[model samples]
Target: MDYLSRTKRQYWIVLFVCFLIYNALIVGLWLLLHSLGSHFHVANDIALLICSVFGLLLMIVFSSIISKYLIEPLKAIWQLILHISPSGVAVPAPNIDSLKTGRELVANLAMQVYQLTAVAGQYGTKAADSELNNNFVANKLPLPLFILDSGETIIYANIAASDYIGTPVKDLTGKNFYMVMDMSFPSESTLDKWLKDVKANTATASMSWERVRLNVLDNHPTRLFDLAAFYNKDNPQNYETMLVLFDHTKQYSQDDQAVSFVALSVHELRTPLTLLRGYIEAFEEELGNEMNPDLKDFMQKMGATAQQLNAFVNNILNVARVDNDQLQLSLHEEKWDSIVESAITNIALRAKVRGIKLESHIEPGLPTVGVDRLSIYEVLNNLIDNAIKYSNDSKVIKIDAHLTHEGMIETTVQDFGVGISPNIMSNLFTKFYRDHRNRSQIGGTGLGLYLSKAIVSAHGGNIWVRSTLGQGSIFGFTLKPYTMLAEEIKNSDNKDIVRGAHGWIKNHSLYRR
Candidate 1:
């Protein structure tokens, strides 16, 4: 039996028995008085009858009045006991003077009960207010909090709980927790068994749980959070589970930014160093026979050191740009034939300067390709420049442009320069991943290819290299088929006109997105 329910039943039974005893006493006193009146014959028969009737009526009226006053307060007490909400209700107590002589003690007892009830109500109100304030503060706290009863039903949750589940607090309550995205718990039997074991094993036992991934918001990829459950130290009847989110997305983004910055910066530095290296080599060649032979060797070594430094700077800068997502590709509509011609024309001087011949073949009437003009220009420059740098003197470097059946515009840069090694091909797009096979002769920052790939990707294109260690390399990328922005706007307007029945689904997508 429930303790509080059993206590209430006992109270009511005791009150009923007291009422019966008091009524019985009143009836017994009346009967005794009547018997005395009949036997003593204090007056004639008619007088006796009148006096007895009067006495009986008076006694009945007084008993009824006393019973009414006393029962009213007792009934109020019973109601107060039954009410769960702690609203103030004054117990209608009896005035001691209004009670019959024999009922004065009962009235006094009733007044004392009323006073005790008032004091209890005051304390209860203070405690409830304190608890409410604590709950308000707890709701705003960062930690995910939940309260559950022995039946495993969620009773309360804080604001962090709403965030963790990706819903408002009101909507979350009464819903089965496991139904929410990415939250899980042990089976009921398993949890109960574990609790039993923990209670049996030691003074205290705790185990760290694994991290759980949950997509707390729509369209976002899953993120990790640490979850833990423990026994409530102050209340053994309850258990609490807490969750903490450790955001690692920003950490990864920062690392990428650092790499991209290093790549771009190094590439920028190399351009100046390359110019310096060329001057140094030219001076050394002119002064070679006139200066001491040993001095000539020292100058050659210094020039070589400068060349290597320039290459190192370029590779770091290119890789950094890729990682940081800072590689910008300015997209625009441009004729494929014209863009190809301009790209080749710009790099033609560099190829000629390097004693490498330049060749170009562009398919006529190829539809305009939407691409970042500046980024594509750099891509062409880097590929052609690298070809000239590594090619045997006066070797040919070819550039080609065409359209694919899949509505893609493709561009390729073919170079006969000492080709990329199979082992180093995968690392070519990586920052500062130099091909050490040509380490003895070639010099570059190794960032050009990395940056080129990153730029191509930003323009919604793909880039790859085809090569063998000693043959040549072909670097190519494919851009998406171009469509005018005007056409896109036209399609959007048509979608608006096709509303009504289909509008509902379209509206959902628009709002959801």
Candidate 2:
């Protein structure tokens, strides 16, 4: 197995054979000279001296020839082995055909060694890859797996695959996949199309799928998987498809149970909220004629609580609508600044009642964003509402809007009231996530910020928050600007519908809307 042990043994055998021949020839010459030269002593002595010198010179010449032809090539091979990296492999230099002798056998042997070295290097790489893949399949994977080649042949299957196939993988391999497994592969599906496209353009694609299945071990539970396949993204060869699967039967049952629970709970809560609002309205109406001032104030507070409950129910409905894709945007181009001013006016009375100051810092030349005027107004209203609710008396809530370099209008609502903790920042945009670490004294359904973030994102923009506890918070969002096409313009009369009131710049509208 070791280079020196094997090569040195070969060199010793060759040297031994050469030594035997040299000894035999020397003995034969000595015997012949001893028998023929006894009669001519002087002449034989001179001839014997010449023969000894000639034999010595000849031994030196033969040794040099052997080193050049046999020993040197082996030494070069040994050097090549030493140069190999930890992987036990190297890319051999091009075959030195110039070193080859005219002898046919020598030339043939040299060519074979060159070819074998090339093959050996490739084998080393494949061996490493095979070991890694086997480890990954046995330890890392939680589900059964198989990789298919372009011809739909099973190229690699893991231990899970063997367990799922109800037989050892070796038995299933080389068997036409469709013949062994009674399943249908759609010819018109994305998988087939991807294969064709890859062949045509030599580009990779991820395949879409609805379902897949596998046979578990005999007497074991059979498995059905929802699956998707993608071309091997990392490899340039793209010779295989990576199949991902999930147990859909379990997931489907869980979804069914969740739906039933939500349906029952929503029904139960709706009845109580409806009754509370009805009673509050009746009490408020009765309070209009009440003589007790304390009772009247209590009734007014009850009315406000009832109104908050109503808003909570409305938020739930809106979220449900969005989840079901039933929420429609009545998009129109409207004055950007005018919408902000209108929202400010609408909330001015509420802000004053709460003893909070509302202010705007609009950029001098901010462009309009495409949005449903009412939806954008709702987003601003929630931020301002929360600011006023959490702030102490005389705290200022500043709303700023400006045009960004990428043509988006960036709007931020800054509140220098109680800030949020970093741990809770991630959950702020999630539905019904209340930051109860502080500001527990304030009231909300916790849906306001969540709904506002969703609405802004749905408009092809992003919303984010920056905050440090005990410092302040900045709730910011970006929106793409809306531009009216030349053909959309009619007379100023028609333009009034798109433009906001009081010379307000048109904010946003969709092209097709």
Candidate 3:
């Protein structure tokens, strides 16, 4: 039967038993009183009156007990259920253990329900508090962040994002994401297409686009943002996209100024250095026979110093050009043998001074390469000069060239020196990167390898290095073998020949032995 029906039956049975017991006690008292009255020759009305008064008092006491133990506790439990809230359940102290069997069962059931509700309420409170804390932290972040819903609505935005758009976050929400931020692309169709793609690819955990332009609606300056969008794994269909913006304008401007300064300074310095070299050469030519041997040697040293300065200046200029994206190559068909021979001859004096032996092995019948002769010469000169400087006790450098399986000419500059460690090898060709271990021992601007890599890449080639820590190092680069089609293209009347994309060169895979 239901709890209510069972409780009603128990109540009826308890009342019936109480009635019977009260009647039995009253009857016994009457009987005893009657006998005492008879024995003492007292009035029967007095005995009967006393018994009735006592019976009424007994009924009152039993009713009070039932009200306190059963009625009050059950009423409080019912009130608690009715007033339940996330905060907690409200109920008076319960004496469920002292109650009769039927009332105690009802009381226990009510307590269990209250306990479950209290536990659930506690969990709900904790979850709400955690969400509030997360929101607080997100709003305090320095970078602008936005939470956009699936319909491209601005459901949430942080304080930085608000300041960026010159509006309060409250005003920003409930508005179309693109409308509030005023993000634009090179073309409207491009923006539409990108948005479509992002929405369609919901399976992607996170997506990012760098260097996106943000056009503020409140007349604030437009800025570049590295935007990232992510989904809530639990509720992907309804989750918001997290867009973060990282500013890089100041960094770009600083880099631009630095490159311009280097380019200008190098140009200004080259003219005077050229004049000094010319004068030194002229002096040596005029007074060679009359001057003492020691003086002639000094003049020749001055000449060599001037030449080294000129080369250093050239390197700085070229590096600046690369940074400014002004590097251009004049492609022409050049015999690889003659190019290598010329580079070796130019560095012969330096090699002799350093007591380093230079060796070259060119494959017979090697095809000519399409390249800018001057740029390739610079690459060879830089590699050989580095090899000489790091030759250590083993003063040997070798240059080898042969046709690769890909039909490209691969040239390697090998040096028996303190080979590069694994940690430093990865960053060897990065601009302005110098090995801390060798920086004190070697004098270099750290731009030679970087520039060489850039020039080689411009010719649609790849460059890499392989080295053992203490054994030796081999730096290699590939060049496209000259073909009739490439020759014809080079011979075309077009003076502006652009080969590769103008940007940083990614490291090619290291050529394994």
Q: Candidate 3 local accuracy as lDDT?
A: 0.74
- Model-by-model lDDT, in order? 0.59, 0.63, 0.74
lDDT of 2 by residue, 279-306 (tens): 8778768766864876766665665555
Q: After aligning candidate 1 to the native by TM-score, how far in Å is the CA of 99 from where it should be?
A: 43
Candidate 2, pairs of clashing residues: 334-507, 335-505, 369-508, 370-508
* Of candidates 3 and 2, the better by lDDT: 3
Model 1, range 1-513, lDDT digits (tens) per residue?
353354455545655665676567656656665777689864456555665676577667666755664465455445434332345564443343443232333344444544454355435432342332244345555776665444445555667777765678777555654454444332243334554665556444444333444545566655554455554433333333222334444554565466656656666786778788788778877887798967866676566456445434544544555565556443445566766666666556455545567889988888776665556666776787777767755379888988877778888988876787787778988766687866678767677877888878876789988996567889898887667333533343323221211122332323111
Q: Report the CA-based lDDT of candidate 2 relative to the real structure.
A: 0.63
Q: 320, model 3: CA deviation in Å? A: 1.4
Best model number under lDDT: 3
The collision pairs in model 3 are: none
